[model samples]
Target: MTTAVDVLVVGAGPTGLTLALQAHDHGARVRIVERRPEAFRPSRALIMHPRTLEVLRPLGVTDALLEQADTAPKATLHLGSRAVEASLADLALPDTAFPHLSLVRQTDVERVLAQALADRGVAVERGTELVAVRDDGYGARAVLRTPKGPEVIRCLFVGGCDGPASTTRACAGIGWHGRPYTEEVVLADLDLSGTPGGSGAQLFAGRRGLLFLFPLGEQATWRLLATRASHGGPGPDFGQPGPPVPRSELQHLLGDAGLDARIERLAWSARVPLQFRLARRFRRGRLFLAGDAAHNYSPATGQGMNAGVQDAVNLGWKLGFAASRPHDSTGGRDAEVLLDSYDGERRPAACRRLFLTHTAFWAEASTGPTPSWLRAAAAARAAPLVPVILQRRRLVAEGVRVISQLRVNYRRSPLSVEETPHLHGAPRPGDRLPDATVGVGGPPQRLHALLARPGVHLLLQRDAAPPPHEVLGPHVTALRVANSPGRGLVAVRPDGHVGFRCGKVDAAGLSGWLSLICATGQPPGRPRPPDDAG
Candidate 1:
C-alpha cells in the first residue's frame, strides 16, 4: 500500500507528536507513525520548564497539562541533615504565563498531546515501523512495515523524532557524537510512609551520594533518583547489567539521606547509563532530526523532553510554509531557504542546552573523595547565604530566568529581520514576544491567545489604525493591543516569535519580509485593491 502527505513524522514521541500538531495546525497534511505498540507506560522525563509551556501554549495543550500537572514553585536542597530552600516564584517571567516547573508523568504528557492530535483528526499510527527512508532533492519516500503488509509513504519533508537510535537519521547518514557518563543511575517511583512539609521537589547530598525525591501528587508517592555512589556499590563498574534494585536497598538509601520515609511499594524502576551526544548535522536534504534523534543530554537538568518539544515547534511552521508554496506564488527556491533555516537555528540552541546539562551533571554527580569533600564544604558555606540571596527579588529573578530557558532567542537566524535601526530596549526580531495582557474592559486576555490562530500576526498598537485588509493579506491576522510597550507594528511568526519589528507599519517591508521567510511571494489570500496612498 502507498500513501502521500505533506509531512511524514517517523516517531510518535512527544517530539514527533508536537511536530504533527503544529504542522497540521498550519494547514500541512501530516501523518505520524510510531514503532511502539502502544503509548509509553513509564514516567520518563518529568519536568516541563516555563519556556516549554510557553511554546506549547499555541498548540492548545497547555491548559490540559496544567490541569494534570503539579507545580513546584520552589526547590529544596538538603545538605547532610540541614535543608535549604530556593524560591522559584521569582521565575514568573515579566511577559509570560507559566512561572514554575510543572511536574507530571511523561505518560500523561504524551496522552494529552495525543488527544490534541486526535481532536485535529490526525491519529498516530501505532505498530507501524519505518524500515527505510530515501530523500531525493524534491521529496522523500519512507517504507514502513505494518500488520497487514509493507506500506510506502511519500512526503515533501520527513522529521526524525525517533529515539537515539533513529532510523530516519541512520537513513539520512547523520553522525551521532559524544560519550556516556561512567556512573550508572537508578530511577524509581515508589510509595513512601513519611511525608515532607512542602510540595516542592527535594534534593539530598550526603557522603553516600545524591538522592532526589519528587512528590508524585499522592499523599506519599514519590519519584526517587540515586547514583551508584549512594548505593554502597563497589566503584562505578557493576560488571553486568543487573535487575532493578531491591526495595530493601532503596529503603536503606532513604534512611542514609536522613529521610524518615519507608518504601511501601515500588511501582517501577530502571537502571540507565546517561550519555551526552549531539548529531553532527540536524538536516540532510528533505529529512531533519529533532529531540533524542538530534541530541541526547544528561537527565540532571531535566531538559531532554522540553528541548525535544521545542525542536518540533521550531521546525513545524517552517515545514508548513515550505509545503504551502503551491497556494502562493513563491517557487521552490524560497522553500529551500525556509527549510535550511531549521538546521541553522535549532542546532545552536541544542548545543547551548547540552553544555548546561553536562556541567550540571558533573557538578552534582562528582564521585572522587576530593570532589565530595569540596562539594560538602561548598554546600555548607553556601547554605547560610541561600536565604539572603533568595530574598533579593532581582537575584532570584535572574537565576530563574537562566534556568527557565525564557531567554533563548534566535536573533542571529536568517529569518529574523531588523529593518528599523536604533530601536532600543524593545523586543528585537527573532525574540519571543513576552506574554502580556491585551484588549480592554470586556475581559483580559493573553497575547498568546491571539497568536494561537493560524498564520502570521500583525500586532498594532491599540490606538493605531489597522492596515487595509488588502495590504496585509488574508494570511495575516491583525489585532489591536492595549498597553503595548512600543508603537508601530510587529510581525509575529506562526511559532509566536517576533519576525519583523518596525517603528511604523511598512506594508511593503512587512510583505517583503514575509516573502523572505514564509515564501509567500505575493500577499496571501485574496489580493487587496490599490489604495490612494499607494
Candidate 2:
C-alpha cells in the first residue's frame, strides 16, 4: 500500500498545470508531466472571456493575466458592404469585475500558470508521457514513457489533461464522439497596416466561414483567424494541419474584405482544421479526463482553451478534496459520489457549448441551402437591421454575457442542496453568486476573493454568524456580511460553486453538509489556510 503520489497529471498545458496547482495547494502530493519537450506551443486561441478571468482571479493569477490583456479590444462585424461595431469594453456586465473579453496569447496564459506551478516547487516533468493507466482496487497505476525510458508510477488518482489525442483517455477505454468540419482554419502572425487601432478585431462574415484579424502585442502586430474551403490537398487529414497559408492568398482575402490593408510581413502561419469532439464520459473510476482530453471545441468565440481551463478548475478542487482524505473515510461511498459529480457537471456544459458552436458554424460556415439563404439575408439587411440590433444596450450585454460563459450553472447537481425553499431573487445552491462586497465592520472583501482561497467557505449574514462551538470542517472559512437583507447561510465549494443554501443561519444544516464534503476524523477548522494564502 505504498503510493508514489496523490495525483498524476498527464499533461502540462493550461488544464494540467491548473489541476496540479489546485491539488498541491490543497495539500495533495501532485506530479504533472508533459509529452511536449518544449514548455510552450503555438496556438490559435486568443480571446479570454470575462468568466475565465473571474474564475482564475481566485487562483491569484488574474492580475498577472490582465497585465497581458488588451482591455480595450474592439470588435467590429463586417456584413459585406456595411459594418456594425460593438465595443466589448461597453458590455454592461455589472455583476463581475471583468466586463470585457481580453485579447491575449495562449502562450502568455500557459506561461503564467507554469510559473505559478514552479513557484510552488512543482516543476513539470518535461518529455514525460502517460502511456497506460488502470483503476486498481486500491488506487490507480499509470505507465509513462519518459525521456530516459518507460516507467510505471502508482498514485491514488490519474488525471488525463492531455490534448485531443490523449493516451490517458485511450488507456481508460473512453469513447471520443464527433467529426471534423470541412472548412480550413488558418492561424497566422503578421504585421499589417490600416487596422482601426493596434489592439482589436475586425470580423467578416464570408459565404464560406467567418474571417478575423486581431492585433497581438507580440513580435507580430496582428493575428489572423480566417476560414477557407478545403482543396482536398495531399497532406494532413482532417483535424490536423494541411500546409502553411501562402501570402498571396492572405492578400486576396484582405482585399476582398475591403479592409484596404497591407500585409507588411507574415511571421508565422499554420493551417488547422475546425473540428468538434467530446469524450463519452469524463471519468472511469480513479481515471479522469479533463481539458481537451474530455472535450474538443470548434474555434468559435475562442471557447476552446477557455472551456478547458474551466474544466481544470472544476475537477481540480474535487480531486484535491478526495486526495486529502483517507481510504476508510465514509467506507468510500461518499468520495465516489464527489468524484462522479465532475463528469455529471462538466459533460453537460461541454454538450451545451458544442450545440451552440455547431449552430453558429452551420449558420455561417456550412454550405447548406438554409445557411446560404441566411447569409444572403444578413448581408442584404446589414446597413439598417444590424445597427438597430447593436443599439440596444441590454440586448448587447446579454449576448456578451453568454459569450463570456458567465451564466453557466449546475442547479441539477447532487452537490447542490437548498435547505430553505423560501429563498428568492438570490443565487440558488448550484449557481454562482455574482461578485459582491461582504463583511461586518472590518475591511470589505469581494465575495470572489473569499472563494479564491484554497478550501470550502461558509458565508453568513452578520446576525447569522455561527458560534465557535459549532462544528464546521477542517478547511472551512466563514465570513459574515454586514448588511445582507436576508438572514441566509451559503456554503461555497472549493471551485466557487454554491453547495448549500438556507434561508436561516442554521448551524446544523451547515455542519451536516460539511460532513458530506470535508475529510473526516479531524478537529473542526484545524487546517484553515490564511486569507493571503490564495
Once fitted onto the true fold, the runs of candidate 2 whose alpha carbons sit more than 4 angstroms away are 1-3, 193-199, 217-219, 233-242, 329-331, 420-425, 443-445, 465-470, 520-534
Worst 10 residues of 1 by lDDT: 233-242
Q: Write the per-residue lDDT of candidate 1 for residues 1-534, one digit (tens) a residue.
A: 366799999888889999999888876899999988898655668788888888888788999998888764567878755688776653536677776767777778899999999998999999999999999766998899987788887899999999888899999999999887776577788888766544478887765567888776232378788765433433322212235778887888787767887787888675666678899999999999999999988777788888899899989988877777754345566677778888888899889988898887777776777657655667766777767876787766665566667777888887888766324555898888888776633577777766776677777664445565545554566776666644577778877788887777666777677776655535347633311110
- Predicted structure 2: lDDT: 0.77
Q: What is the C-alpha local distance difference test score of each model?
A: 0.76, 0.77
RMSD of 1: 4.1
lDDT tens readout by residue for model 2, 1-534: 234898999988788888898788776799999988996556556888888887777678889988987887777777766677767775677778887778888888889999988898999899987877899977898888899898888998988988888888998899999987776677778887756432357887766566788766355877787776655556554445558888988887677555677889888776877668889999998999998888886676678888888888888878877877656757367678788999999999999999987777777667666776666556756556877877777788798777767788999998888886345655788887688876656577777765776777777655564624445556777776665765677778877788889878666766667756765334434544223211
TM-score of predicted model 1?
A: 0.90
Candidate 1 lDDT (Cα, whole model)? 0.76
TM-score of 2: 0.92
